[model samples]
Structure formats: structure tokens, C-alpha cells
Target: MIEEGIVAFSGWMTNFELLSSGWRAGLIVFGLVFGTATVAFMVSRVIAAMERKFIETRNIWDDAILHAIRLPLVFFIWLQGVYWAAEVAYYYSEADVFTANDALLEIGFIWVVSWAVLGLIKQIEQVLVSPVKMKKPMDYTTVNAISKLSRMVVIITVILIALQTLGYSISGVLAFGGVGGIAIGFAAKDLLANFFGGFIIHLDRPFKVGDWIRSPDRNIEGTVEQIGWRMCTIRTFDKRPLYVPNATFTTIAVENPSRMSHRRISETIGVRYEDIDRVSGIVSDIRSMLQNHDEIEARQTLIVNFLAFNHSTLDIMVYTFTKTSEWVKYHEVKQDVLLKISDIIIGHGAELAFPTQTLHVADSVKLKHLEHDFGRDQGRGDTANEAGERSLRDNHEEAVSQQKSVEKHYAKPR
Candidate 1:
């Protein structure tokens, strides 16, 4: 009876000891989690307050920095607080404590890198909006190229840091990465080429976002929409978007029409050949109209004798330039010039030419008709010569009338 009672007491004591130890361990873990969370919360609030104070100060440089480096940076600070608190409690931590730290460091490094990347992007944005005027406006292609490159650089940096934190030997990893990178670069040669091409475009600045450009290689004309690492997108006047390789842009001759201060206008004007005597008067009138006109800014006039003869028309080219680059205004100027020229041409008492062909039959047919009318003429033999002459004159007049009627029917409209 004594032996059995001692065994029962010992078993009860062992069970109680286990229960107490488990409760204490659970409490310690709970305290560590709670303490880390509390520290993180406090750090976040401090960062937010500092950011708010900085914003309220209204310093331009400080505002840019605070605005650029706020949210992500504050989160990074919170992460650091949690990491530090975890370190402080590591003495009482479980067997997986070091592994947990590694994970936390990985996450923290990524956040830190992300924050830095965002700051860089914000800096670029500020530069674009800077009051310092550029020779050309900032283009979407340039902005995109810069942004994409910055992101790529940040990604590489983050990945390197992550590898380092994950127990990778930095030197060995880099050496292996160099070889692997070479292979990947070869595989993605076109992509890398385009990325570099986009970089060159941003630096060179062939065209801006709203500027119209035409490619010499391909007759494609459009305005730039976006510049990407591999390609650039252009929105055509017809509202179609064109995706072109960045490398091709560098190679092609791009004509930016919007960059010009004015558009060049050249047209040919046709006047009747009979108006040769009044050509000078017409030219002077046209010149005066162009010089005084509100739309056209005439540079100089050239007497371009395009066609010496067009059977009925004379071709003269009216070479000129407009001051405005607007398409609608250009059309208005052209229409005005044409109308004035047409009025002047008609007022000169000269009609434009029409094609006419004179047909002649053999003299035998006339002789045959004359023979048939021999009897009638013989009866009036005394006045035969006079009567024949009058009849022939009337017939010639009628033939001339018929030819004019045919010519007028086939004439082209002015």
C-alpha cells in the first residue's frame, strides 16, 4: 500500500511540473510577439509624425524628399523595429529563432530596396517638373525609359541582397551570376539591345510625346505615346497604335513635323495660254495678296514656267510658304489663293483651251455633188459664177458653226 501511494504522488507531481513549464514557455513567446508588434507600431507613428512635420515646413527640397521617401521608408522602419525586438528576445527564443531572423531580414531588405527605388523615381519626376526650361519638352519615351531602367536596377540590387541574406556567399554567387548572366544576355540579346536603344532615344530626344513624326524606312507617321525598354508605341492620326522596336528608331530617319515653326506650301496654277500678255499683272496681284493676307507668310516667289503649252492651258507653279503650322489654316490660305487667281484669269478676257480636231473629206465627194447640181446651175448659167460663190460661202459658214458646237460639248469644266 505504501509503494503504490508513492508512485501515484510522483506521477501527479511530474504532470504539474510539465503543465507549469508549458504555460511559462507559451507566455514568453506571446510576450515576444506582442513586444515586437508594439515597437513596430510606435516606430510607424513616429515616422508618420516626422513626415507630417516635414510636409508642414514647406521646404521645396525637404518636401520632395519627404514626399518621395515616405510610405515605403516608414514601413521599412517598422520592419527594422520588429527585427531589432526579435533580436533582443532571441536569448529566450525557440530553436527556429535564427531562421526566423533570416526570413525577416530578407523581407526587410526587399522593402528597403523598394523604398530606395521609389525615391529614385520620384527624384526623376521632380527633375522633369523642374522650373529649369529644357530646349525640348519632356517626352513619354524618355520618362518610360528612365523609369524602366531604374526599376531593373532596383530589382537586381534587391535580388542580390536577398541572396546574401539567405546564406549565399556573395563572391561565389556573383561569380556564378556573371556566367549565368552572359548566357541569359545572349538569349535575350534583342531585349537588351532594345533596352539600350530606348536609353539612347531618351538621351538623344528625337521627338516628344505630342510631336508628329514620320519614319523614313517605313512610311509610318504618328505621335509618340510611350517608350518602353524593348519597344515604343506611337498613336497614329487615324487613331491606330504602332509598336516599333527601339533599335529601329535609332537607325531610321525620323522627321518631326511638329518641331517646325511653319509648314511649307507649294502648288501649281494653270492659266490660259492666251493670257500671256497679262501674266505679269496676275503675278503682281497674287504676290500682293499673299504678302497682305493674314494667313500666308510668303518667303519669296519664283516664276516657275512649268509647261510652255498644254494645247489650251499654261501651267505656272505658285511656290510659297505659310507662317502658321496649322493644317486648317493652310487649307484656307490655299483656297483663297485659288479663288483670287480664277477671278483674275476670267477678268483678263482670255478663255482656257479646249481640244478640237478638223476633219476633211476627199474633194471627189464635193465634185460628185457639184456634178449632180450641174443641171440646176446650167439653168442659171448667166449668173452661175455669182450664185455658186454665194452658195459656197453659206456652206462654209455652216461647217464652222457645226465644228464649234462639237468642240463646246466636249470641253472640260474649270
Candidate 2:
């Protein structure tokens, strides 16, 4: 259809034979420009319709291809139109300005082709990482790495091709690059290290984008936002962005909490010394509770035993794992487990421990001391005795009040 249109335009141009060559060339240039615009517009509309149609289909390649070629196709049309126009003008006027027309056309074609390929790579990368487009989306880090490497390969190839087209010898260019690479590598050694580090990360698959990672070796604890060639961006818990060099991951030991199967719940509950006899029963009930609980992972190691005789309490060690690795949900499960344990202790008529001390004295010693004090007061007279009695009564009342306050502070809900 395009060839037929061009032939018809040629027939129409021949009708202006009476006009001068310059006038003929100018008219042809105008015609080519108009044709280019019209063709480009039509192509864009067609591609848009095709994109909408292909989007509904399960196959993503058609959509990606259509999207990739839209702009480049239009550019190619304009390039050919302008090249033809210049050729016509040069043929008529024999101007030196249009001498590089062939070279320009070749270079332009290379650029447009490379541009489309790069666009296609980008589209495929996006499609693979999109959950809606793919049933099982590819890893973002892997897709990104592949896309970048593909684009780099396309660009380097285009550059070499363009140089060859411009009459530069391919072997000579390669030889020059080989000699210059050593200097370039040394000058950008850190950059090369970071790039290689990123490449290693992509290969090793230790952690990926969006993983919550922490490093004990450094203060790197955050959700990975992006893994770039030079640096990895992490968003910390406090919502601050941390830019760490990619090389840092090569040396540091990263803990990926996001990849954990379960979150641990390890706690030590202490009961009053008076409840020592009930310790065995309490531990037994706790172990049973953990084994039967819905949130706890029964398959994991679950231990509930009387661990130690603490100064003020009998400590029971509760070591278990929750079924979920989610931070908030794990905490909720832990809270429920702790509350249930508390209830079990209460049901067994046992109380949680608090610091306390008891002192024992012989009754004879107490009586002798009281008697001596009383005798001394009597000798001092009735006024001294009354004062002593009042002080003793105040002290007793104060002690009782303090005891009640302490009991109130430690009181638990039924």
C-alpha cells in the first residue's frame, strides 16, 4: 500500500514538468514532509488500537512489541522522509551540506533500532515483575538486573556498529579499547567493585527488593527499597532513607527477617516462692497450652520447665515459636499466650513473684527487750511513758498503711 502511494505521488509530480528543477525539488520536499507527518500519525493511531486489543490477550509479547515500536517507527518514518528530501535537494543543487546523508541515515537507523530493543526490554521487565500480568511474578531485583544488562548490551553493540558505519575499523577500535580499559578500571575501581557487588547479589539471591534486612556488623536495618548498580536504598523503621554502597553487602552478614518461617517467643515467668510446690503443675499446663495453641508452631521445639530457684521466685522457662513471622501478629499471639499462662497460674492458686524478705527472732529475746524498754520508760515517769506509747502506735499505723499500698500496687485483675 505504501509503495502504491509513492508511485501515485511520483505520477502527480511529473505533471509539473514546466516548473524549474529548484521549484520541482522544493515541491517534492514539501510533499515528503506532509507524507511523513500523515504516515506517522496513522501509524501511531494503529499502534494505539493494537495495544488496546493486545492488552486483553494473555500473551504479553504482542503488547510489549507494539509499545516498544510506536515512537521508533514514527521516528524512522520522519528520518526516511527527511533523507529523501535532502537527496532530492542535493541532486538538484549539488550542495556540499547534504554530502553526509547516507552516513546520517545509517546511524539514525541503528539508533532507532537500538531504541526499540531497549524499550522492549523495559516492557518485558515490567511485565515479569507485575503480579497482575503474571501469575507468579518474577523477583524485582532479578528482573531489574536482567533489564539493565540487556540495555547495556544493546547500547554497546549500537555504538560499535555506528563507529564501523562511520568508516572506523572495528579491530582498531577494539584494540584501543583493550589498552584503555586497564586505566579506566583502575580509575573507577570502587565503581567497578560496587557494580560487581550488585551483580553478585543478583546471582546469589541472598535477599531481594522489599526484604526487611538487618546487619549486625553495621547499623543497616531496614526494608530494601531499591538495589541499584552503585548503591542500595533502604527505608529504615523510623521512615528514613539509607543509601548504602552495594559493596557493603559483599562483606556484611545480612539477616532477612522477611524470609523467616516463624518468629520465636521466648520468655521466663517467675512465680512466688510459696508456689514452689505448684511449679511442676504450672510447667506441665504451660507445655500443654503451647502444644495445643493455634498460633504456636507445635512442630518446633517447645520447652516449659522449672529453670531456676530465683532469690524471690521460682523461674519457669517458656521457649516456643509462633506459626507466623509477621511482627504485629506474632506479638499479638505472644500476648495471648502470656495471658493464658497467667490465668493458669491464677487458677492453680499461685501468684506471680515479687521481692520480699522475712526475718526471724526468738520470742524470749523480744520479750526481754520490750521489758527493758518499758522499765526505763517507767523510771523516766508517766509523761515519758505516754509519749513512748503514742510513738509506738503511730509507727504501727504507718506500717499497716504502707503494706496496704504495696498490696494495692501489685494487685492483679481476676
Candidate 3:
């Protein structure tokens, strides 16, 4: 009986010890999680303050950086906290899974840092290349190439480092990758060519996003939307998106109409031939109007003169350039100037001409010449009819003479 009591007492002590350890571990986990939460709150507050300060700066890139880092920084802080907790558990707990948990937490931390780095690189690009007035805007093709290259470098480096840290042999992976690369190269020939073409476009910089481009090779005209590896996206004026292969830009001659300094307004105004006396006055007045107009470009070529005499009207050509290159403003200015020109023509009692053909007969010599020609034609017609009638009568007399000769010859000899 005394031995059974001793065994039962030992069992109770063992259970008590297990319960105590469980409570301690629970306390530690709770304490670490709570501490992490507190630190995260403090860090987020600091970042919010920094963001506000950055936004007040004149340079917009700084603000953009702050925004980019905000979420990543917070995420990193929490990831670090999880790593520390796992590290704590690994040290205290004698369990096999704890080691794995710690390793995973470390890897997670590395990945978060890598992700943050990528975000920073992308955000920095905006600061480095986006301010058109402060810095030269990067070419669309080149910018995309740089961004993609940067991302690849970061990811590959991180993966290699992670693999090395995890005690994996990289040589076999590299060998396998090399063989796979050859196969992929053959299979994706067009894709690779398009990627190479993207590189050329980046270097050449024929067009960029939002710039209007038209290809003389075919009927492709639109504003650039995005330049990518395999294809470029263009948004047309008709509110549709066009996808073009990047390789096409390398082969075709592209015209960047968006880069033009000014828009042209060349027009031909025709006036009635009766307004000949007012043609010179109208040309000079129109030239003055173009010069004095604020929208008309003064430095460019402005030609307003009586250009040609059409069959029905006098053509006065007005060729000039508008100061603005915008499509809407150019048309508005052109419409206003044309209306003013119309008003000027009307005030001078001149009318716009249309398609017409007029026969003008001169009273002096040309009229007499036309009458004499008509009489000659009529006399020729009368002579032709008289000759035709005389020929018919001769044919009748010849037939009758032949008939009488035949009758005399065929008659019985008397």
C-alpha cells in the first residue's frame, strides 16, 4: 500500500510540472506577440509623420518614395517580430518543428526585405526619370527594360543567396537551367525577337507613352499606351486599344506627330471672278489678319496671296501655322480665323465661288469669226447634199441608158 501511494504521488508531480511549463510557454508567446504589436504601432506612427513631412517638399519623388516604403516598412517590422519569436522558441523549446519554424521565419524575413527593395527601386525610378521639366523622361522602351532587368537581378540574387544559405548545391541547378534555356530559346524565337526589338526601341526612342505615333508602313495610328516586352499597347482616338508586336516598331518607319512644335492651317479660298478688282485688297487684308492674330505663329511661314485664276473663280491661298500644337486649340483657332476671313470677304462685296463653266463670247472680233465659221460649215453641208443628189441622178440615167441598149440589142433583128 505504501509503494502504490509513492507511485501515485510521483504521477501527480509530473502532471503539475507539465502544466507549469505549458503556462510559461503560453506567457512567452503572448508577451512576444504583444511586444511586436506595440513596436509596430510606434513605427507606423513615425512613418506617418515622415510621410507628411515628405509631402510638403517641392520634389514629388520624395513623397512617392515615402508612399512606396510605408506599407513595406510596416510589413518588414512584423516579419522581423515573427522571426524573433521563432528564434525565441527555438532556443527554449526542445522540439524538431521549432527549428523548421525558425528557418522559415528567417526566409520570410529575407523575402520581405527583397520585396521592399524592389518597391524602392520602382519608386526611385519615378524620382529619377519622371519629372519632365526637371529631368529627361526615360524612353518608354528603355524604361521598361531597365525596370525588368532590375527586378530580375534582385530576384535572382535573392534566390541564389537563399539557396546557398539553405545548404543547396547551385551547380546542378545552373547546369539544368542552361539546358532548359536552349530549349526555351528555340521554342520562343519570336518572343525573344520581340524582346530584342524592345531593346532597340528603347535605344532609338522613336515614341513614348502618350505620344502620338503613325506608321507609314500601314494604317496604324494611335497614342502609345504602354511598351512591354512582347507587345506595345496603343490607345486609338476612337477609344479602342490596339496591341502591336514590339518587333514591328523595329521594321517600320514611325512618325511621331506629337513632337511637332506647331500645327498647320493651310487653306484655299476662292472668290467670284467678278471680284477681281477686290482680289489684291482681300489678299493684303487676310495677310494682316493672320499676322495680328494671337494664335497664328508669327515666326513661321505665312503665305497669303492671290495664287491662281481658276476657270470659275480667283483662288486666294492662305497658308500659315498656329502657335499651339494641341489638336483642339488648333482647330478652334483655325475655325475662328476662317470665319473672320469670310466676314472680310462679305464686307468687301465678294462672294465665294463654286464649280461652274461659263461661255464668254467677245463682241469685237471673236464673234465675227464664230459667225464666219458657222456660215462656212453650212455652205459645206449644202455642197455635200447637192453632190449626193447629182450622183443619184447620174446613176439613174446610166441605168436607163444601159436598159435601152439591152432592149435594142435583145430585140429581134428587123
Candidate 4:
């Protein structure tokens, strides 16, 4: 009995020793996890602080980079901690299978890596799309399309890689997807057409994002807001959104007003007929003003001429082009020129014409001959009326017969 009791006590002591060692290992792993997590937290804070400082003084690329990487960095920190903790626990506990814990860490690693790669892609896109970053900047539409396509490719590749790592048969999956894609292609012909149209638009460089385009063939005119894969979103002047199919751009004529070299100002100036003698001077002064004005284009046509005589007044024409292509600036320049022309005309003692008519009368003797002769008509009595009625009846019957003859000759048979 004494020997049996010693044997039992020895087994209990061994189990207690194993428990103590595992507790020590767990404490060490806890310290490691906490220390690493604290470091990661401090690093993230530092990055955030730097981003804020950059925003206050420098360009935004630094801020964008930090923003994109922060999540992935934090995720990787936790994954590393978990991995080290599992390794410590396995060594202390004498367990042979770390399958479950390793699997979780591995999956987390994949997610972190994928996220980091995607973040880098996003940073690249943001930098490239920034208007101030590049000297020869690409338009927003093209950059946006390329970004989306790249992201899709990256995501698909990452997903497939992860699946393969997890013992998935990628060949069967790809074959199925290929067959399904063919079926879907047939089902969505119009959608594919629009997709290709969008691709062509990006390649051919038509109207870009933010451009004001007008369709002469259709009722579409607006500022481009988003160029999507299937369609483009246009915000009209009245502040309504219009979704136009990409295929429509390929079929119709689009006028991009944003690309115009200049804005035109054409007007007709009518003057009082009495001021017709001053018209030539007014035109000469206007032409001089246009030629000397800073906003008027030097190469474009400038016309200030006496156009023609109207029913009530003489007309002058003013036609010119502004140097600025922007609408607001063009209007400002136009108003200044118009105001100057008005001042010049008023200073010359000439008035802008309104519609008017004039009538003249002859002497009273000639006016009397033109008066109605009612007394002569009163002398021609009922005899004249009866003769007129008989002649009118004969003419009416003859006209009716001629009309029926013409209708019978030309009308279609039933």
C-alpha cells in the first residue's frame, strides 16, 4: 500500500509540473502578443500623425498611402501575434496537431496580404488620378476604368490563389466559369455591347469626364459625372441625372462644348432711321474697340457693319468671338464690349431703334377724288340688282359643273 501510494503521488506530481510549464508558456506568449500589439498600435498612430501633418503642409499622396495601408498593417500585426502564441502553446502542451490554429492564422495571413496589395493598387490609382500630381494628367474616365479593371483582376487572382492554397481544384472551377460565361454572354448581348462601347470610348478619347456634351440627334445635353462600365451618368443643366447607354455615344454625334477654342457673341443692332447717317461712324468705332480689346480673339472674324434697311429703321450687325472658352468669363467679356458699344452709340447722338411706321397725305382736292361715291351707287336701283342676281346664278352653276369635272378626273376609285 505504501508503494502504491508513492506511485500515485509521483504521477500527480508529473501532471502538476506539466501544468506549471504550460502556465509559464502562456504568460510568455501573452507578453509577446501584448508587446507586439502595442508596437503596431504605436506605429499606426505615428502614421496617422504623419498623414495629418502632410495634409496640413504637403501633398495628399502621403495621407492616401497611410490610409490605404493602416488596416492591412494592423491585421498583419494581429496575425503575427496569433502565430507566435500558437507556436508557444504547442511547444509547452506537447500537442502534435496545430492544424486548426495554423489554418486560422494562414487564412488571416492571406486576407492581410490581399488587403495590402489592394491598398497599394488603390494608392497608385489615387495618385495617378489627382489633377495636381502629374504634369501630363490623364482624364478621370480613363483612369477610373483602368483602376476598376485592375482591381477586378487582382481580386480574382487573390481569390484563386487562396483557394488553391486551401486544396481547391482551380481547373474545374475555371472550366465551369468559362462555360457559364459563354451562356451569360449570349443572354446579355446589349450589356456586352455597352461594355465594349465604353472600352472604345476610353481608347478613342471622345468627351472625357466633366466634359459638357450635347447630342444633336437626341435630347441629351449635360456635364459628364461618371463614366461607368455599362453607362455614363450625366448631370444636366437643370440638376437632374441622366444615365446614357455607352453604345449611344458610338451611334450619335456628340458636341463637346468644353473643348471649344472660343465663345461667339453675335448681335443685331437696329438704329433710328434718322441715325442712319451716323451708322458708319458707329461701326468704325465698334470695330476699333474689338480690335483693341484684350478679350477678343486676334485671329477670329470680327464684323461691325451696317446690315440693311428695315421696315421702320436701319440695322447694324455686330459679330465677334471672345478669347476665353469658359462660359462665365466669356459672358463677362461680352457684357463689357456690349456696354461699351452702347455708350459709344449714345455719345454719337444716335438712338437704338424701335419699330415705327410713317404715312403721308396728299392735298384735300386729290383726297376728295379718292373718297367713296355712295350717291352714284344709290341711283342704280332694283333693275341693276335683278340683272346682277341672274348673272351670278348662271356663273355659280357653271363653276359647280367645272369643280365636279376636276374632282372626277383626279379622285381615286374605290
Candidate 5:
């Protein structure tokens, strides 16, 4: 029907002898351009109505399909219209540039179709991952990985097809790529490593976005914000952004605290040595308290024992886990447990230990005697003090002898 209309229009244009070929071509070009705009507008309006209608339906595929094709369809229409107008111009002007019209049309069609397919893939990925759109939303990481792989495949296929359309052999391209791949791999070894690291992460599923992960091998303690092909972004405790290469994860061991079942609260409390008799009772009371506490995980390793006797204090170990794993809530639970332990100790009439020291000395007479001897040594003064090593040694020996004699005088028969 459209061909017949065009033929009738051409016949009608030929009947106008007054109009030159250039003028007729110009009119046709104007008509084509105006028609393309009108067609694009109509298609957009039709797609908008279809989108509104499909959005209400339960199936999401229709919406995705309509959305993906809307812009690309308009573009395809414009391309065809312009192609036809250029053909007419070429026929009249015999231009050399328009000779590649067929290749350009094929390439443009491939590009448009690839664009639509990519758009559809992206839309489907979004719909699957959106909690509001899907009843059971898919994992964002998995969906993203699949979407990326699919898009890459689509892109590679499109490129190959475009090359074939431009008179390039697919087999030759593949052979050259296979041979050049080795050199490319060597040149971009790190880049390839990071890429493969990301791929492994996607497959292994060690940690995902929003997981609190820390690496003992590296100073990487943060919540995962974004995981990309080359690097991962982490938000640290201090709210700083850290960009780490994906390859780094391949070598390091990551601890995902977010996946821990419980947070440990291991502490050693000590009491004064005087509370030796009360140590057992305190330990028992602490264990009972932990067992009855709402926040403590009694089913796990609950250990409250008198660990050891220190110099000034008796050590009591409190090793247990909290029922909660949230960081802030875990601290609160730990604080409550510690305060309860303190109360239990106080109730048991035991005091927490502190560092202390005691000094022992001889009787007052011995002290005075020592003081007198020290004064006598001072009285020997600068002459003995300034004496050479031999003289000082002789004086020290003399003092020792005199002190022994005095001690003998004060000694009793017993």
C-alpha cells in the first residue's frame, strides 16, 4: 500500500512540467523529513500509551520490550527516511559519498537492534532486582553479574555481525584475535587479574554489597559499597571512601563480620587478694547471671571461672557470646553484662583489685644503727671520698669490719 502511494505520488509529481527535477527532489526531501518527524511522534505516543497499559499488568516483559524499542524504533524510522531522501539526492547529483549507503544502513540497523536488546536486558535486570517490582527480589550482585555478561555477549555478537556486513570475514577476525590475545594478556596482566578477580568474587560469593568485611592481611576494614570489574569501593568506619583493586581480594582472607552468628564478649575481671574465699562465689554468681541474662547466648560457650591468682588480685575470666551481632547493640549488651558482673562482685562483698605495694623494714634500733653507720661514712668525708679505688676499697672493708664488731657486741646468746 505504501509503495503504491509512493508510485502515485511520483506520477503526480511528473505531471507538473513547470517544476524542475531539482525542485521536485527538494520537495520530496522536505516531504521525507516531515514524514519522518510525524512518524516518530506517532510511534512515541503509541509507545507511551502501551507503556501505561502494560505497567498495570502483572507481566513485566511487555513493559520492558516496549520501553527498549521506543527510542531505537524512532531512530530506525529516521534512518530509513533519511536514507531514502539521500538516494533521491544521489540519483540526481551522482554523488560519490552516497555509494556506501547500503553498508551504512546495514550497520545502523545492527546498532539499533543491539541498542534495543541491551536496553531490554538492563530493564529486566532492574525489574528483577527491585523489591517493589518483584514479589521476591533477586540478589542484586547475581542479577548484575548476569546482566553484564549477557550485555557483553550481545555486544561481541553485534560487533562480529557488523564486521561481516562490512565485508570482513568472521573466521579471520577470530584467528587474529586468538593470536593477539597472548600479547594483550601480557601487556594488561594486572588489568586481566583484576577482571578475573571480580569474576571469581561474583562466582564464589565471599561477601556482597553492604557487608562489613575486614582483612587481617591488609588494613581493609569497611562496609562494601560497590563492587566493579576492576575495583571495589568500601566505606570505612570514619566515613572515608577506599578504592581497592579486585585483585587484592584474591590474595587476602576477608572476615565478614556481618555474617557472624554472634559477637564475643571475653573479659577478665580481678578482685583484691583479700577476696580469696569469695572467688568461687563470685564466679558462680557471674555464670548464673550470664545464664539468666536476656542478651547473652547461653547455648554457646559460656565460661565464668576463677582463672588464676595474681600478685594482688584473683583473676576471673568471663568468656561468652551475645545474642545480637549488631555492632552498637553488641556493645550495649556487653556493657550491661559488665555492670551486672560488677554488681555481683559488690554484692558478694568483694572489691575489684588495683595495683598496690607493701614495704617491710627492720626494727627501729636496726634502722638507727644503719643511719649512724651511714653518717659515719659521710663523716669520713672528702678525703676518703676523693681517695683512689684502692683506698676507697680499704675504707669499705674497714667499715664492714667495724659493723660486724658492733653487731657482735649487740648479739644475744640465743
Candidate 6:
């Protein structure tokens, strides 16, 4: 019974000694877990308080940082706390029976994964929100493209980090990537051409939205409405949308009428042959009149010429240009110029000629016709001849009689 009691007591003493020896290590593990949890809770509370303050103040940017950016930041903060706890665990383990280098490697893998994931989240939030704050009107395509580009960069960076962590040398990987990129460049030559074309458009600014453009090669005339990476979108005057490849626009001649300060208008005015002699004087008057015309550059008005002599009349063409492109304003200016021209024509004594021809009858035919008339009634013809001569005398007598009657009617005044 005494030996059995000694054995039990020895066993209890051994167990107690072991428990006491491990108490500090156990306390460190407990503290690490407790500290990590405490820090995580405190971080979340602080973030919540910040969001509430931002909302109350009505600060949009601050609100974005709180609501939009806080989640990733919270994750990183927790990761940091975990990282510190992990370091404490490593220190405690170093003093124990086991080295935690293997555990540290495991933790490191987790850390990298956490960093990549959280970083991705932060980047995506920034990409989406950055354009929201911009004052310029947002283009969805541009925003999406920029977002995709940034994501791709982030993905590539994460891939490289993962590869490095897995013990791959970056120098060798870079060399392989260089060779691969060269092959890709050769394969996507046309895509590269379009990409360069897009860059050229941004730099050159050939045309902007709402501009009327004419492409020489395609015989396309339209208003520019959108410019994209692969194509330019144009809305035709007929209201059809045309998507033209950037390559074509970059290589072709583009006529942008919107770039001009004013448009030139040219036309001709005609007059008759009877007005030809007076044409030189008319031309000088027109030149003087055009000098005062608001729209006309008299230097460019080619001529007021006697263009041709046609079958009936002479053609005088008036060639001139207007200073404005607007169709309505141009017509108004032209109408005023024409009114002055018509007034100038009427001021001259020579009238505008119509198509006319002079008919000549032979004297022999006239004499024959009169002789026949005389023979048809000889006695009557003699009397008609005396009557024809007496008709002039009768007109003179009638005029004298009318004059005497007019004088008698006015005699009362005398």
C-alpha cells in the first residue's frame, strides 16, 4: 500500500512539474491569439466610427475612403496583427522543444496570398471610384479599359511574386518573357497598328465630336460622334452610324469642314447681248459694290465676263464667293447683292434684250400687191388715193378744231 501510494505521488509530481514548465509557453500562445483578436476588433470599430463621421459631415471623398477603401484596409490591418502574433508565436516556439521555421514558411505563403487578394480588392475599388470623382463626363469604355489594364498589371505582378515565392528565378523568367513578347508582337501586327492609330488620333486631334468630316479614300462624309480603340464612330447626315477602322482614318486624308472659319460659295449670274457694251461699265460698278459686300472677298471674284454669244442673246456670267458657310446666311447675303445688281441694270438706258429677229419683205412684192389693189377698183382706188392724201389733211383739221375748242373753254378765265 505504501509503495503504491509512492508511485501515485511520483506520477502526480511528474505531471505537475511538466505543467509548470509549459505554463509560460501556453500563456504566450494564449496572449498571441487574444492580442490578434483584440486588434482586429479595435480596427473594425475605428473604421466604423470613421464612416459615421464622414456620412454626418457629408464629405463624399472621405465617405469613399471609409466605405469603399475601408474593407481592404481592414483586411490588411488584421493581416498585420496576425503577422505580429505569428512573430510572437515564433519567438515562443524557439524557446520550446520545436523550431517553428517550417510553420513560419507556411505562414509566409498565407501572407503572400492574403496580400495579393487584399491588394486586388483595393486596386479594383480605386479603379472604379477614380473616374467617378472626375469632373469630365465619364466614358464607360475608357473606364472599363483602364480598369482591365490595371487589373492585368496587378495580375501579372501577383503571378511574378507567386513564382518568386515558389523558388523560380526572375531573371530567367524575364528572358523567356522577352522572347515570348517578341512572338506576340509579330502575331498581332494589325492589332498593334490599330493601337498606334488610336494613339495618333489622341495626339493629333484631327476631328472632335459633332464635327463634319470627309474621308477622301472611302468617300465618307459624316459627323464624328465617338472615337474608340478599334474604330471611329460617325453619324451620317442621313442619320446612319458608321464605324470606320482607325487604320483607314489614320492613313487617309480627312477633310474637317468644322475646322474652317468660314466656307466659300461660288456661282454665276447671266445678262443679255444688248447689255454687252454696257457690261464693262457694269463690271466696274459690280467690283465697287462687291468691295463693300460683307461676305465677298472682291479679290477672289474671278470675273463679270461676256462668257459667250448664244443664238439669241449674249451670256454674261457673274462669278463670286460668300464669306460664310451657313446656308441660310449665305442666301441672305446673295439676295442683297442681287438686288443691287438689278438696280444697277435699270439705271442704264440700254434695256435687256429678248430673243428677236427682223423680217424683211421685197419691194417688188409690195408694189405688185398695191397694183392689184388699184386694178380691183380703179375709180374707188383713185378716190382711195385722194382719200389717203386727204386723211393727213383731215388729221390736221381735226387737231386745229380741237385746239380752238380747248381755247374757247379757257376764254372764261381771260
- Which residue pairs show collisions in model 1? none
What lDDT tens digits, residue by residue, belong to model 1 across residues 1-414? Answer: 422543464457567775443454454456656765676677667766776787566454555665566566656656665555455445334456554875876768687768766786866665565555333546545665667677778878777778777778889988998899999999999898887888788888887666788977797798887777688788999999999899888778889887777766676566666678877676677666667767666554533345456655665566677777877877887787778767766776655455555658578866665554555667767366765665566557777888888778867654
Task: Show model 6 residue runs off by greater than 4 Å.
Answer: 1-176, 298-303, 310-313, 317-321, 326-328, 335-414
| Residue 192 lDDT, candidate 5, scale 0-100 | 100
> For residues 184-298, could you state the per-residue lDDT of candidate 6 as single tens digits?
8999877878877865776577776668899767778988887777777999989999988777877789999877655454434445666777877766777677777878866
lDDT for each residue of candidate 4 in 1-414, tens digit (9 for 90 to 100): 423543464457577775465556666688869988897898889888877887775665677777788888887887887777776666566587755676777778888877877887778777787777756666677778888888888889878877777778899779888999999999998999999988888888788889999998999999999888899999999999999999988899989999999999998887788897788899999999999999998589988899989866687888999999998898899889989988988989998766543333355733343232223334555355554554456555766777677656644311
Against the reference, the lDDT scores of all candidates come to 0.68, 0.87, 0.78, 0.79, 0.87, 0.64
In model 5, which residue pairs have backbone atoms overlapping below 3 Å? Answer: none
For candidate 2, write residues 1-414 as lDDT tens digits.
Answer: 433554465557778556665676688789989998999999999999999999999897899999999999999999998988787777667789999999999999999999999999999999899999889999898889889899989999999999999999999999999999999999999999999998998899888999999999999999999988999999999999999998999998999999999999989899988888898899999999999999999999999999998877788999999999999999999999999999999989999887654445466865565566667667777565575675566556766777777767755532
Quote the lDDT for 174 in model 3.
86
* Model 5 alpha-carbon drift over 4 Å, by segment: 1-11, 359-414
Q: For each candidate in turn, give its C-alpha RMSD to the true structure in angstroms.
A: 9.1, 4.4, 16.6, 12.4, 10.1, 16.7
How high a TM-score does candidate 1 get?
0.67
Q: Write one digit per residue (lDDT tens) for candidate 3, span 18-131.
A: 545455545556777888889889988988998899777777766676777777777877876676566555545657776676467667777877877798888766655666
Number of clashing pairs per prediction, in order: 0, 0, 0, 0, 0, 0
Name the top lDDT candidate: 2
Better of 3 and 5 by TM-score: 5
* Runs with alpha carbons beyond 4 Å of true place in candidate 3: 1-20, 57-70, 84-96, 128-145, 357-414
Model 1: how far residue 53 lies from native, Å: 9.5
* Predicted model with the maximum TM-score: 2
